[model samples]
Target: MQGTVDSTPVVTGHEVAAHEEHQDLRVLGLITFLASEFLMFAGFFAVFLVFRGSHVQWPPEETEVELLLPAVNTLILVSSSWVINLGTKAIKKNDLAGMRKWFGITAAMGAIFLAGQVYEYMNLGYGLKTNLFSNCFYLTTGFHGAHVFIGLVLILGVLWRSRRANHYNDITHTGPEMAEIYWHFVDVVWIVLFSLIYLLTLI
Candidate 1:
């Protein structure tokens, strides 16, 4: 009598059809989430515009918002977006060391931005209940700052994953790309917020 060998088929994630389907689903999900976020921010922007239009003195005579520090922080935050892209591009070129350096700098820049936000809040000389402008400024910017913090966490996670043995390469990385998109989104939101809150005040 002949004995039979036991061999079961293994299913790897490299199944092209399954992988593509998962990728499509993930991309669609992310877009939907970002769209909902856009609507929320739109509502806040509408509220700000309504209050600004109704009040003759927006910031009032006693309240002042200095533009220098916030502007510097904005530059830092925006620059981080550029820096992290360099990391992504570096990995594309198979330059792991360069990628790590750029990502680390990007994370540091994010930290500096959050620090600047905290400093600004402490020295603003106004409370959340100060006035409509102050209230909106704190609320909108505080939320943006929290998102920046979350982006930093995401960047750090990418950095950590990059250390794994043979884990990521230029064509093989999606997690970092997603994190980059999120950081860029945060940067864009800050730009809009800066225009509405900081630059508008200067005018």
Candidate 2:
């Protein structure tokens, strides 16, 4: 009689290679999307700069853009970037608990940052129609807030998926990786925007 054969199915090396290649393509797609996003934001920045250049006063003589709240919001976003990285690392290590904790914090921080933005909008002494600077300010920052909201949604989705067994592992974590990339992009773009819109005015 023939010896009993083991019945477990095995993953082929070719299958693994193909999965990696697909993951690479997904990452490349995200990068391309972000490139387009950057161009759009650059256009907004150019418009703001044009308006600033033509006027003797940047935000106009009467309008004052507050700094304290935005500074706090900046800190929140920067911290969230770090937190999300921790989550990405945790998922890579197959530590779902750590990933959940860190990503949860990151999502909370993002929500707080967005709330702060809305509060700032409520308190700003001018309206979008008040002047060109005000218009650019609302447009650019509001666009960024929309991105933050999307990032938060993405994080929550990742967290939900993380609930599944073996959903993400060292070699299978494209979702967390992509979400991390997008969140970092959001943070970096915000840093540039904050410097240009808030810090530059102080000089």
TM-score per model over all chains: 0.86, 0.88
Tens digits of per-residue lDDT for model 1, 1-203: 25876554345455754645434355456667877887887788889989988988887767778799998999899888999999889888878888889889999999999999899889988988988788898899988888889889988998899899767786676777777888988898899988987788766
Model 2 lDDT per residue over 1-203, tens place: 36989755556676775665422588889999999999999999898888888888888876778999999999999999999999989988888899899999999999999999999999987888897788899999999999999999999999999899989888888999999999999998999999999998998
Model 2's C-alpha root-mean-square deviation from the true structure amounts to: 8.2
Model 2 worst lDDT run, 10 consecutive residues: 15-24
**What clash count does candidate 2 reach?**
0
- What are the Cα lDDT values of the candidates? 0.84, 0.91
Query: For every model in order, what is the number of clashing pairs?
Result: 0, 0
Give the worst 10-residue stretch by lDDT in candidate 1.
16-25
Q: Judged by lDDT, which candidate is best?
A: 2
lDDT score, residue 169, model 2?
86
Candidate with maximal TM-score:
2
Q: In model 1, state the lDDT of residue 25.
A: 52
